[model samples]
Target: MKRELVRNREVGIKSGRSASYYFALWSISAKLVMDFFVPARDLNFFVFNGLLVALFLLLRPRLYLGRRGVALFVVASTFFAALALKDGGNSIIFKIASLPVLVVVFFSIGRGLSEAAVKRLFKILFVEFIVCFLLNYVLSVATGLIRSREFWNFEHANLLGSYVLVMLVPTSYLLYQLSNSKGRIIGFVLVLMAYLSTSTGAFLLSLSVFFKAKNLAFKNIMIILLSIIFVIIAGLALLSIADPMTYDKIAAPFKLINSGGWDRLVGEARNGGGITYLAADQQGSFTWRAYAYLVYGFFIAGETWDRFIFGNGVGGYEIVWGGAMPHNDFILILTDFGFLFFIVWVSFCGWLLVKVWREYPQWFAVVVAFIFRLLCENNIYSYYVASIGCVIFSLIFGAITRASRERGAVRAQASRAVA
Candidate 1:
């Protein structure tokens, strides 16, 4: 593993070279709005990210095609195969648009960074991004350039808030490991402020998930979470009773991410549906919404043999939804490429999850948090999300490789002793 680490340096792979590192840096720089600052499919995304992927692969070509890698290949090939059988410009366009994210997947497979190395990289990005957020907030206030519901350059406040988890989960976990209680508290607060700035349901949900990590005990976390929930409910109840108008104003921010929080509770409809959300909102849960939408879309796409099995290919969801973006990765993926692609990708993701749990049980919580976000968001289609996934998977894969190398070293020592 040390030899691999040295080789990484020989190939110019630094902490700054990681795709996940750039996901944080580029997102922070997004306010500049220049093509150079953009992290999407821009030249910079191509040049630097591509260079990073290239160097890592150059050092360890063997890491390029593990079981997970093969699964992704099968998925990508299925997409192209779907495109070939279908007739539409959108299918071609979708394929082209997805290529950059595919490259991100390559980066993950190319660099099998050990668990410690991955944690270190994540911590560095966490501190740097939080510092930038503080400085940017101050500067934006001074200049009065900050727009309402906008944090940094994210057009959607939820994206900014939830994205902070990419840093927060790892930083908190690291602090817990290092026994730096004060540092952990400060990092949690800073990250929480960034998260609450948007008050997005998904971001809040991610925070709740973070509590279950190894850093915190189950009983303590349950007590803390239950107490918070109780307070929020009591406050809303009192506000509603005391001043309806003031209550509306106070709950306005909360309602932005969700249409109705407490109001729905007070209404008679609460007991009617087991799921409390709008049928359209999937009860403000991406998993529920995606499941509901996909069932409907499958029928809409038709039960024809080929269509049912292979789907209408990429962009077929528009035919089902009248051109609205699916806004759910599962539904969008399943409807576009059908059962084959969806199954392969999900299986690969499941394998990665198991590997993470097996290798670094401490990080299982962090993995769960991000998986929830991925389920709720169209991260599968987002390049930034792809980069985040790539970096995370690399850690587990790297750790696996490290373990294998250690076993081999022990065997070599035994053989030499026998001589």
Candidate 2:
């Protein structure tokens, strides 16, 4: 028994140390790559998921598969039934094949994280943003590689901008919690940088942060001002629509709302034909991507109402969507798997968010960043997104579990003393 206790202590120490190192590395590396350079497609996907797989292997045994596992099994069984009834590659068989691997990775990492590690990870992330932003500015001037809007065009700039906004949330929260005035100022500056980037999603996320801040009266005033500004912009846009030629040279800042301006932009693209045109043609300016996935999900749910009650098998979206993965993570599960999987997935996320909010209300800022990104990008199912999500989840859950265990121990001791 003594030997076993000693071994357990050693294991615990090792786990804590390893978790801290990995967390720090991930935080820094993610910021650096996203900010300075255009992420390579394959590399981007692989790094995110690869880190998750590594985390899972490092932190093993305390797995929490939740209802997702059971749902996957049911979906697999249904797929097998379908296979027995018919014959083709359309069999549910292919869908079930990927579930085991995903479960193993997600649960393993989820069980590994601790609150202290998460706090440290956030610190590393903050430093990374500052460093990367400065470096990007320098590189742009020296090499002129990233100066033109053309270079940062399309999904790359949009995604990177979203990342900056998302990182700002946790960084800002951490700064507020640090009790250092200088640190808070630095965090505030980072927030300013994110705002100035002018990524539409980032701008919206910043607005979310402003509203969620501790001062309710101030938030209300800000909201009123924002509404007035929007109204003014709308009126200008209406005028522009009525007199396209007169407004053409006026260059309205609210060009997004002007159909005439939009037509001109689209026409220019059709006549000139480049990446900008392709981007403009994308439905609803990329927001439509989520709706597309949602529509796809409804179609799947309609077809597999019975089979998907549990799930259509885990990771089934990869097969169902084929080359084009669903742009919405929520829809990915709901449509490809079923209502059961969707409920479980959403419940788990909701629980995590609530817990984070309860313990560290400031972290909600980070959550805003993530949600804004989710609106425009489907990072939830993407390998990197899943990995980061799992790590963050693990850290939050670990903190909650550890705190509960400590409280329980203290209560037990007090009861024994009274006895």
Candidate 3:
């Protein structure tokens, strides 16, 4: 009896040690996923490679090689093959291929997380968001004399704002799942951080869409909207007090709006073609973007019948004026590849949307938060955007997939018991 008890104690100790090892790997992998926005070269490279090694060590084919997961893999493999076949030596193929691998890594890691583990991940991300926000605010305050947008060494203020906004989707969702008070408080804090970056896209979506209102009544809706407008005004007022020049920098992109010059925006674009046409407005910092979006619309309108059907071909984004995106995903995808590829890509996205939504249709607000960004910024073709997009989407898919599997297993177990 003593020998049996000793053996049982040894087994329990081994299990405890194994769990600690598993969690150490999980925490490191999750942190690497969280830090994709920090633009330190060797650090990201090390963390990313370290993540891959950890993933390889922790891989379980049963989790990823299942029916729905395999279906996703097949779709991704097909898209990669298609991109490779059409690569005209432009670097789109590399970006295209790397996305799914990143998604798979996150998915593999996230799939194994228990509820407690998932909550711990959220707290880590919550801390990360606050830290980055403080860093960006400090740097912007310190460097106010030099730069228009302070990115805290990421890609761009707007892009980083978008990243933070994306992080808020899962952050808010996870917190909401835990408790409403926690969700509302943290959600507001995050939105305030995003607004400080002056990313109109993030501001619009994160506040107007993701954050919750008290009720569904029209009065509540109006109050929430008015409250948001008030907070924005108040926030900018505070920013102006801290640094008027920084406020000016934040407000420059909207000088057209104050002047009621949106009508003038279209005339600027139709002035000529290409980058020169967009850059015609010497007085306007943002008129060029307005000009470019209009130009892309015209270019799409002028596509040859065959080109319109198939896209300009893969890597065909080079033909874009100076090869920069119109800061629109639909325009970027449709123009580079063609209507068909764009449709396929969009349809697959729609499927994920439906799958995710079916799990909880209320989650559509979180999904639309990023969709709003897609309308106003460079889409997943960007490295930062791709990394942020993959981590969030894969986490949702992984979590949902795990729940689905557990339900199936429970049902199977019941069936076996009945038999």
Candidate 4:
């Protein structure tokens, strides 16, 4: 009877392990496909996140739960509570509904980061980006759809372009780390294709790669300089042929591009009558609610403090901004939750940045892209934002955890040897 029982336990363990391996693969593949092809859809988040959560719960006994994990839970709870209160109970209820999905995202990232796995995953991503971009472009041109603005309306293309651009720096760095001729050639070709796509974000991302690689080889600098020169020359040629009315139409956007931060802020403040000029002849509401939250938090204390600490909750921004998410993530946190939550959120970002720097410095391009995008888009609370955030956070946490374990093992070995 004892022998039979032991056999049953062993079989259970083996089955569990096998299930986990398949689950991890499924989660990673789903994430990649969603990221590339269906990024704008909420359903992708639901499917991927559901799988991730199931895997985590099933494997929790074997997973490490540490300080960071505890902190994450606390932060999530505060945000969840804030959402509930802000939305008149609906926000909280929705967050509860979504909790399982968030867990899956967290676990999926954690499970996918073995060193060999990281390299393999990146290689596949690089290939996919190339193939997808080519196919999209070819289809667009062959169908005579390339000239239509509707061709650019596919949100997935924009998202993928942004992803490639944001990842270019890190991808290049990975190539350098691999230090193989084939890796370098493939990386270069991928970057070249990304640039040819003329996705503004991707082009900017390529600049990041140039700066990162410039010190190692003058060739990077030369390529960047040539690209800039070519763009300028092309612009001049177009301008020379453009009608005066066309030139006039384009000049307003140019003025906005040239307006510095302080000038824009001052203009917004002076024109506070529910409208401000974003560019010449282009006007919209320019309320600086984010600035208001920061200043208010500094002045208020107590349950005003709870509001400051926990945030008004998820949809709290709507109360202050008339149904608009705060453009600044920092302000979004302060207004929605409060100062305490804001500080913790910022601290988490700092910790994640350090981890990425230590283990995957090249991936910093994506971080930069996120920051750049945030200047114009309130991405932090969006479904896509949450998915990307959870994945990256899980990856960093896993890397940090593994490093700590390895260090402890090394120290233990040395101590025993000395004894």
Models 1 onward score TM values of 0.61, 0.54, 0.73, 0.61
Clashes of 1: 1
Worst 10-residue lDDT window for candidate 3 reads: 276-285
What is candidate 1's lDDT per residue for 246-292, written digit by digit as tens? 45544543553365444443332222232334443223333334334
| Over 4 Å off, model 1 | 1-45, 48-50, 53-116, 132-148, 186-190, 193-199, 208-305, 352-359, 395-419
lDDT for each residue of candidate 4 in 196-273, tens digit (9 for 90 to 100): 554443544555553342132368657757977897567646754863333333343444445554455444434332
Candidate 4 matches the true fold with a TM-score of: 0.61
Residue 389 CA displacement from its true place in model 2, Å: 3.6
Specify the highest-lDDT model's number: 3
lDDT of candidate 3 over 7-108, digit per residue (tens): 764463344322322543454445444454365644664566566566566643223556876788878878777777777375656556777776776676
CA lDDT, every prediction? 0.53, 0.51, 0.63, 0.52
Q: What is the C-alpha lDDT profile of model 2 across 162-252, one tens digit per residue? A: 5556555455546555667765565566656654453445544554443334433567658856975896578448747874433432333
Model 4 scores what on Cα lDDT? 0.52
| Candidate achieving higher lDDT, 3 or 4 | 3
- TM-score of candidate 3 to 2 decimals: 0.73
Measured by TM-score, the strongest candidate is: 3
